[model samples]
Target: MNKILIIVFFLSAQLVYAQENLNFGRQKEIISPQTNTDGTFTFRLKAPNAKKVEIQGDFLIAKGTGPAVEQMKLGADSIWAFTSQVLPSELYSYSFIVDGLKIRDPNNVYLIRDVSSVVNVFLAGAGKADLYMVNDVPHGTVAKRWYESAGLKVNRRLTVYTPPGYESSKANYPVLYLLHGVGGDEEAWMQLGRASQILDNLIASGKAKPMIVVMTNGHTSNTAAPGESSKGLYKPIMMTPDVFNGDMETYFKEIIAFTEKNYRVGRNKADRAIAGLSMGGFHSLWISANYPNTFGYVGLFSPAVLPPSNAASPIYKDLDLKLEAQKKNGFKLYWIAIGKTDFLYKNVSDYRKKLDAMNFKYEYRESEGGHTWSNWRDYLSAFAPMLFK
Candidate 1:
């Protein structure tokens, strides 16, 4: 009788312990970043001991003062909350500032890593941001690929996205060589820019034709992105030893060779496109100019138009001559886009002036925001639809 009573008591105690330790009911009660009916979002943070709380995100205008931070109102329930005005349809990232330290919202699970910083993310309305969401449309395949680079003397890694029905169909598709910025790696476009999602959505909507996207890591100093190579778990840096020295543009042929040999893609010039953001834009400009007729379509999204201060490399030599040659060589498109407030706006404008002087025909697009993933994603959406047409 005593043993039975002891076993019952022990079981009851274990049950109570499990409920206390593992029960998340209280935490689940806190719903944050609630997308209200009117297209606004209400962010909530449960901070009982925090004396001050604020919300900072891309949704608010920075106005050159860094991120726009808004104060949150604390209620009697010890929860701090802030309701934003009606936001446009876009994917936005934000963090909570509890008393001074910036932190992610505990309630939001969606996060994206931009270089070394990680932040929580949420979608606003249902317009432009619909491309960023993984809708019920036919999806594509994103794979990590490694190619031998004889110039760099290492096996470099890249990301490739094959459009939907690629595996089942024997049809050859056009190729788009997508490049990333200085601090980004092969994964940057897929993660922050939502390249695959955007492509899937666009192709489904018939706005863009089926194509293959090869996302290359432009930082040649390392063989791959941080922690994905011999360099183990090292923190990412903005500058690389081989960057801005024309090495990437010089050795870019290996990437094209690898993609052509392995993937079922068209080899014609018109079937090839190259485009990138920021530093990648600089690379695309030079690569297409140096190897004329290789890529019929070229896109420079907020490119760093200035040449390297020390242009001793032969690849950087006779750039104006190369531009003249590229102009003479017939191509389908040379598209340039930039945000009005981007730091590179002046540089791009100056480059446009140079192009005007040479009477080069190119299309230009101007957006509203500065250098950001939002603009880059939007650029990809607009640029992809015009290719191979």
Candidate 2:
């Protein structure tokens, strides 16, 4: 009887191993994004019963607009497939619409959450956009840290990226205070912008100086990013009228202090930089102007500058004065970039005209696209290489 029991256990082990091997074989057969040799991509979905299926993605449409829909052909095996044209080399967010309900690619495991929505992601080609892609290079470390905000009366969280060998080396590094736009948190730059990978590749290639990049949550009312607060509430903390008045600029000083005390970063203005996109661009403008001589390098990507209707307001008056003071201080780089067709083009153009009138020394650039992550990522790629030089 003992021999029979041992035989049964041996047979069970064999059965389990065989089952596992079969499952692995099945996994190898699943492919969603099948990249063709000519740079086009074939995305497949196994919705055999769906009457209508379509594909949409960032690569297919302009920024800030709804996805450009492309109908997928139903295959003989009931699988739905769509082959894209030769797309540019870049990371793209996409989804499948089946019978009018949008869904992520089941076979594609990579995903990203923008605001409240989650979408599948894919990388195509190896062009200038390859800087954003992850390569076999020395990688940096990205971490989320909480700091006590005395002004806001809450503990706020920010994402910090330390360059490779930061842990083992005892070197002081310059810090770039990177900010994100509205509806985005500290994670936006790392996720959507792929800032970590960009820095890693640039630093490895000797194109960019290795530095610590601090991504701060710009929303003054919220301690952390959306859905990341300790209070278990997803709703944003609404700022009081007073806080909206000018508290954001003041609150930034605390963030800088916290970063300096906690990290081995330079404390001088020459060792500091500030840049952001959209609302973040606005913050960068406000912070750098209000706090003169704070950052040597300032970047504004598609800045959301409102029309100058209230030239008499104290804020505008203060900005005017601050601009002159900033110019006198002699900054290293004051860079502004906007998409030609962006909705905020007029505002930025008007602000540029004002700066021109003031003789404020700044570099202005215009690209092909509108307000989107693509332009912002490209802006960072261009701007970072010129920092701390």
Candidate 3:
């Protein structure tokens, strides 16, 4: 009888201990990101049985070249945790590699998709980075608008950002044609670039004029971004050939015509601006050169102006004639920026030399890091304020 009583007492005590240790309700809090007052961050993942876990993120190092993997430590409650060092004020994306598979943070709900992959996102600080954040400012509206592309013979989509009070006001606003990189589409600026937030905050602060920002899909053959249309069911093709074939120019004209017809925007060159990053930068170059008098303001963020493989290529064939025309037309701002360590640094430098030789008046700005979105976002923040001023 005494043995039975002892066994019962032991089992009850074990049950009570297990219940106390189990994270029944506090699991969410335990695994969620905890921002410390000192500007560091603690990320936790609840994977008890995982043999190995590591955190990889853009913020892990400079140059934004990461999968800067850092091993996570296992805690008492089987939660793996990693604390980041004092990070700078910016938005960051991170994911966990459990065993060998890459996975996003289940605790984090804020995510941004790039190309076809999605990752968890978090903001590290305030103040300078607040432009990228959703502040208590009058926000703009971003809409996915479809238009018939006469050039491609397909219905195309683009993202448009209308400033606050635009719905109620009958004001005719200036337009800014924003372009994305090779793998990006209309949604790139809206999602990754935080175009709406940046424009909203800048306009609220009186830094940037209230203007309509149009983000277009640079892909010539595709109507919209991947998975954004029924056409996306077909295999994606390379846009490089189409770009060189002058299909983009036709697409550009179609988009411009559509914008003029649909939106209450200025018609003249003085009220127009165009800017892009990487391949979009290349598009901006070709587009601005092709229609020299169309845009008053031009910005190229880490433009991919590759050295000509042969003189027969369209990108290099035009030579100085296009730039000369642009110079004659007169531009309000020809802003160009690139990271010092970017892979295309040499290409941009060589192009700048050509510009210098031609006396092509341009504002050059160099930033830190490589071919990454951080510099691209910074470029937009700086470039937007300069427009229509």
Misplaced by over 4 Å in model 3 are 1-23, 62-66, 232-243, 306-316
Q: Each candidate's root-mean-square deviation in Å? A: 2.3, 4.0, 4.8
Encode model 1's per-residue lDDT on 1-389: one tens digit a residue: 69999999999999998897666666447888998898889999989999999999988866676779899999867889999999999998999999999999988999988778889999875799988999999999999999999998899999999999999999999999999987799999999899999999999999999999999999888888888999899888888787777889899999989998998999999999999999999999999988987989999998887677786667777778888988898799999999999999999999999999999899999999889888999999999999999
Worst 10 residues of 3 by lDDT: 307-316
Candidate 3: lDDT over CA atoms? 0.86
Off by over 4 Å in 1: 1-24
Candidate 3 per-residue lDDT, tens place, 1-389, comes to 69999999999999988887675655546645789989899999989799999998887864444457888999877899999998888888999999999998988899998876789998876656788988998988889999998668889899999999899999899999999987788888988998998999999999999999999988766778877897745445444455555566545888888899999999989899999999889888888987889999999999987534643446445758989999999999999999999999999999999999999999999999989999999999999999997
Candidate order, TM-score descending: 1, 3, 2
lDDT of 2 by residue, 186-305 (tens): 888999999999999999999999999999987766677777886575645333233334566667899999999999999899999999998789888988987888999999999976
Clashing residue pairs in candidate 2 are none
Candidate 2 CA-lDDT value: 0.86
The residue-level lDDT of candidate 2 at 136 comes to 94
Best by TM-score: 1
Q: Which parts of model 2 have CA positions greater than 4 angstroms off?
A: 1-28, 61-66, 233-245, 307-317
Better of 1 and 3 by TM-score: 1
